[model samples]
Target chain A: MPDTIAPRSADAATPPTPRMSGVGRVLVAVYGILALAATGRTAVQIIERYDEAPVAFTLSGLSALVYIVATISLVAPGRVWYRVAWIAISFELIGVLVIGTITLVAPDLLGAGTGNPFGRTSTVWTLFGAGYLFIPLVLPILGLWWLAKHRPAPETTGASATSTAVTPGASGAAA
Target chain B: MIAWFAGVQIAVAVVGALLAIILGLLGRKPSDLTMGPLILVELLLIVQVVISIVAPLVGNEPSGSLLEYWVYLISAALLPIAGGFWALIERSRWSTVVIGVVCLAVAIMVYRMTQIWFVQGL
Candidate 1:
């Protein structure tokens, strides 16, 4: 008698949650590094000068939060994490662009003196992440590309059956 | 920290990073076999942490905020461990690459630590 396989529900098999493998690992590693870097930079900035530049420091804090969420989203499994990765990565791109433009156009707003409301350019995106060699400028674009490449396959008629058939082989390869 | 000693450690870690990159380019997966250099870098980081704490006690006060230095030191110690955790789970050439990244990060951190200690003074 041959051994039998356990049947899983269509909901379980057909969703096709993307695993953080291959190139995703590199992306996650980079995100994790950025998360740590941003968190550390913001913590030091906030603690050292909360009164000097509340707006700038707060933005730094927010940027750190975004990196942290993106890092987690990339590593986690499931469709929900996939969506979260998109949201976080998109937000990060927006942040870099908006803040980069603000700093470039009105340096004094984020620079010291002149009673600049936004304070000094202390956040990660300031001057397009010049302090960190512009990685902040480029990372989100890469993240977007990676996410697009790993986008879940569209739901199709017979997808459930196809997914069920492919499940074991997928699991085998993953293992 | 003893600036020269810490600099040496950072240099060695950078070299370790290069070795890991070579392994990655050669398509090597992370394993116990490839872990030796990474572990060495981690050990050096641990030593740096101790040196960071002791150096200040011995009158080589960090030029920057002591709190900032401590934070960098503690976080530096964790970088390799974090990379190792990811590597263990991934089990691919990318995992080894991640270790290279971790080493590079550690190198930069040590350089930052040094800058925080020495450069700000000048």
Candidate 2:
């Protein structure tokens, strides 16, 4: 609620702009961790055996990119970043659902990607993120909720360039 | 990957978690008192990294992909410090919770490293 711990000096012409704070901090932290995990896993998978499962590995790489973008957008302020965050989070949700369903219903489809006799390939959203305690599945939903709560006010609905004079901390109070 | 190391990791995580709970109950932020256990865990993790790196070079063939082990070790070693610095910056009670989460994560990672060492082979 409060912009920060200390009281603002009278000369403070602009209100403190809230990029990330309170519950947002926890959200960003989780996103940051997931981004790192996905990045690391995809990097290792691609480097070690890219040819073994190109499709699966590429999906993993895409998932990693989504996580990275979501984390950055969440950390940035203004209406533009807000929209970017929504898009990234929505894409992530769709990816998990599509990948999870395809992996389950049609293992044969991705079997070529695995190349193993059993047709087993693990992506970030495989089995609804069983490997990561379902965080991958649950995170985007929470992100959406947070984004809805933090949507920009009507006056700041313009693009990033036009909202430079807007006070973010004042608007964040609505969140 | 050693038994004692894994045990210590779990113990440190448990200690950090309990400390964080105490701070929550007392309505406290991440002050010096609450951060002590996290600092201790960070120290232990650094020690583990040093030993893991040096032990292998000295012909102690650990049973796992050395690359994976190193990544896990380095990440584990950094987790608490990163959390600590964030807590200092945020100065909120949730910061204490962040430290707790990092400690738990480190514990899980260490366990995974141990499993990698045993199951994956050197």
Candidate 3:
């Protein structure tokens, strides 16, 4: 049964939505900026002053890694990339919430106390991302919503019929 | 960073953001009107990069960490390019808004760069 219709349906159901289109483009752009910002800041912090705040710098590196992964996953094609996007974004949200709370509750634990040389917190998630206008806090939530809204079409069981029905409508709306 | 040049860059970015936001709210796609200011912002950023290279040689060294200032400046310069490329590819209302957001981010980043140069001394 699966082999019979695979040829025709495969192309149609290959990718339900291009994740890099329309509003997703904006999301990707923002994610790209955050990735660049985080990576650059983390590199500087870890390279120049790792001894001063190892914990904070490490977390910053983690956040940068997550952002870079999320950005790439969002732009990639196919179901595996989609799943990766979900995992990365979910982790980002959790990281932001947990790190934000930690920074707020105990800044010293992250080496954000007066003992720090920079005289300010530096993590991407510090104080709920206040340093970045709280975009870090909000971005993951938005990413999750986007993922949920744009889930790929199931590839088995009535795949062709549903995909054919949905494709025109999606294209029409986009147009 | 020259004080007046930084101020001009911020002002241009803010105005560019406002223009893009207005165009986005109007449901307009990425057009000349929406992209023009962004191009100007990118040009200003290019000028900024050149100035950043030249300013210190002329005896106007930043009081802050040179690494931090350069990182901020280079990162800020990249925003407009990325945003403009996204606008060109997407060519939608949201792309315009993204440009607006990028412009706003650039404004803030430039201000930060100025702070690092003039205020945050090592």
> Would candidate 3 be rated incorrect, acceptable, medium or high by CAPRI criteria?
medium
Clashing pairs in 1: none
Best by DockQ: 3
Each model's backbone clash number: 0, 4, 0
**Would you list the C-alpha lDDT of every candidate in the order shown?**
0.76, 0.73, 0.82
TM-scores, one per candidate: 0.81, 0.79, 0.84
Candidate 2: lDDT of B44? 85
Model 2 stretches astray by more than 4 angstroms: A1-19, A106-121, A154-175, B21-26
Local accuracy of candidate 2 as per-residue lDDT tens digits, A59-154: 889999999999999998766788899999999989878877776677546645332211224677876676667788899999998886665433
Q: Would you list the rank order by TM-score, best first?
A: 3, 1, 2
Cα distance off (Å), candidate 1, residue A163: 23
lDDT of 1 by residue, B1-122 (tens): 78788878788788878888778868999866557778888898888777776887888887776776777777878888988887887788988988988888888878877877876445
CA deviation > 4 Å runs, candidate 3: A1-16, A112-121, A156-175
Superposed Cα deviation of residue B82, candidate 2 (Å) = 1.4
Ranked by DockQ, the better of candidates 1 and 2 is 1
For A1-175, candidate 1 gives per-residue lDDT tens digits of 1111113223235544454657677778878888997898679878876787677778889999999999998877655687998999999999988888887787658545212222233688887776666888899999998876665433345666788888897988888
Q: List TM-scores of chain B, every candidate.
A: 0.90, 0.87, 0.95
True contacts kept of each: 0.52, 0.10, 0.52
Residue-level error in angstroms, candidate 2, position B106: 1.5
- Give the alpha carbon lDDT tens digit for every residue of B1-122 in model 2: 46687788778887786787567456578987768888988888888877787777787666756766676777778778888899888888778777777777777777767766766543
